[model samples]
Target: MSAVQGLIPQPSGLDREDDVLTAEGLTKTFGTRTVVDGLSLRVGAGEILGFLGPNGAGKSTAIAMLTGILPPDRGAVTIDGLPLGGRTARTAKSRIGVVPQEIALYPSLTARQNLRFFAGVQGLRGAARAERVDWALEVTGLTDRAADTVSSYSGGMQRRLNIAAGLLHRPKLVFLDEPTVGVDAQSRGLIFETVLRLRRELGMSVVYTSHYMPEVEQLCDRIVIIDRGRLLAEGTRDELVAPLGDGLLRWELPAGAPEAVRRELAAHGRVESEDTPGGTALVITAHDLARALRAVTDLAVRHRLPLTGLRLDRPDLESLFLHLTGRAIRDGS
Candidate 1:
């Protein structure tokens, strides 16, 4: 089995017809800087949409606008066919759940207590609230540990409880922001199963944000990538990676090798070189991997130069992301 298959169940081919959530021309600005610009997307019923961007990509700002937590400078959000503002704000808010990146559970409270509190906040009361609390606990696989203090639970358990808190009201749409940040492998697997079951059994729609590429590739029905708060690309895994071609060829050579080698390899494809721990790494992007490999091999044999390492990697989301957004590390919002 592939690495992704081991992490997530195969797609269930859920029929997602009408959209449960839609955002149009969403724009947000802080002082002179426009954080999110003309951002727009939609989520279909029972569909999982992968929301992606690098750090400081305005993704959080866009999400805030989508959830009605922060008002967009200009845009409209419709939830379940209702505008997510004014008289319908309460109704629209109730139909969606937000699982923030940070754990929102009270460490001092028991898991059950936390659920009961959030349930009440959602206007759930009496036996209805009790029933929902029980349902949330069961859905998150925390029934056995409902009475335990959240402070005592493992990081993964706390993460699950955080998810349960958002689920008490059984919203039609759920936004999960990096739901598996710090957890053991077992917990991550369980979280994946829980998310899949939500869509499979309850037909819930989800907008998932994660820095982990494999999770997004395995879990999302469609993907939307943003940078600087603007849409860069949106498509399925194959469609998104197709533009970059079949694969990349990387060769590790001595740091001070003659410039002639670099110039020669450039003829085969788009060649780029950068410093690496192994040595100076030469990366080639080409439409045809076989043709590029043949040219690279002939050049290497003719030169009779020692190669530290060489690898041919299939095109993937990570490559596409760096290609679109550049490789510079982003530290601020």
Candidate 2:
């Protein structure tokens, strides 16, 4: 019998050789609670996997297990074809870089000083260390401030440097755990550009975990969503949200539109749900907002009510999340 035929099906085998990482039935528990439960995932070379979930949905715990910071209570994991166990995972971790959600740089250390320290830890020295530090500074656009302490840098600058630090050794895989949080728009754009450049130029496998739906829509080739410690869904953004393509267009009927006003409006579009304090938010499947707007306005005029808000909302990640979980994407409960 084949090795995988006897054991659990390996997620990595879905791809050809050069699969960067895989997790099969990974589970982690604390006390009576299981943080990560039987989660299986795979990322091939040059693939960017976007991982997203509600808060406390085992995103961090699963990442910890995958990267060797925490042990799985059951199942198996591998990085760069090496089993994630014993000292093997530690050695494998050395070849992979992690940009954690929290900044790992020393506040008192200059950018160059911080890079040098990390270079030493990664077994880089002499000319290679200096070259890497210089290259990182240049790429992160911190060449002018390489001598300044991290405490002196702006939040965006610090984040850029944080990414540069992750790239010093050019690991085969990089996991970014919400690296864009708290960054300004410009910084966010820069980080996005830098991440894309890495995938385009160096063919690195990036596993990005974030709740920011738009970023995932823009950057990821495939997105795997987990909720309640289990895989909820996986596919391209279109594949996952395709059902929503036939979704509703929302509008707010100006205040004081009597209960009967909804009935009149129903002739044009379906009313999915409404909030009284905020006016009526009617939903119509696959309908154009412009036409809905005309109908809503005509009804409001007939009823002598005010016109409130109008929106054309497609079924994006947020809607898909709500569809699957019965609540907002940000709402864990």
Candidate 3:
């Protein structure tokens, strides 16, 4: 199968007034099991949106429905205000490119050959097909090795070729599913550059999904997190992390904290009791670290509580993920 499968090519102009893609109340069920339940999101033109979910979060199922590869039991997908299925589906798909998690290429074929094959799949013909093939090679930095067979290329080169295969027609929106997996740092960095270029140079929108937290934090304009097939959160990094508080202040009390001390600290922040090897500790989450620390110290001194140990933690995406889903973003659920 082709690495990236898409429909008829259309004009490259993007509609800036409306979102590039929007899925409303998407639901999918297989027999008695439901993998995706009312999942919905939007992608703006020239924006890179990060889609994050733990394993078995129905992300793949949602993507299939959004791409028109699978039918949704309930819900609708619109691309540039056109419904994603039925008569307008072809036009809607023309704006999309997909770089799948797996490397999609025929090992025996040369890089150029692989691109030509996929370009044909995208309905390019004659001079247009040849031009697009060259453009894809140049964009992916594979022109120098275009004639080399896929099996002879390094892992990074193959990944770049796989990406190039999906983008032959200069799609307006691309869905990149873990494009950097198993790639070297150089290739990964190159992939980042390519994604950024697609947006800067072509005004393309991107939906990026990866288990790597740093990649999503570094690239996406907004982030959407889902778990158990349900939408849990969506927003910019600061927006999502804000509600979790600014930082965590942990204080180990040589003797268990008194109820009055806990109550006094609660006025400053949310306090939780944690069992530690040394003893019980009070972990407080607050927006202002300096004020929270001073409050803790004052209360401890007033209540005659001895502090055995102390630690502080800043809030970040990983902490937000754990706070919401309680599961680290792993490959398998």
Q: Candidate 1 — which residues are off by over 4 angstroms? A: 1-17, 250-283, 300-312, 328-333
Candidate 3 to native Cα RMSD, angstroms: 7.9
Worst 10 residues of 2 by lDDT: 1-10
lDDT for model 1: 0.83
Query: How would you encode candidate 3's per-residue C-alpha lDDT over 81-189 as one tens digit per residue?
Result: 8899989999999978988989999999999999999999999999999999998898888899999999999999998999999899888889999988899999989
Ordering by TM-score: 3, 1, 2
**Candidate 3 clashing pairs, residues 3+ apart or interchain:** none
**C-alpha local distance difference test of each model:** 0.83, 0.78, 0.83
Task: Using lDDT as the measure, name the better of candidate 1 and candidate 2.
Answer: 1
The best-first sequence of candidates by lDDT reads 1, 3, 2
Models 1 onward score TM values of: 0.83, 0.78, 0.83
Worst lDDT window (10 residues) for model 1?
A: 1-10
**Candidate 2 has which clashing residue pairs, if any?**
254-306
What candidate 3 gets wrong by more than 4 Å, as runs, is: 1-16, 249-261, 272-283, 290-312, 331-333
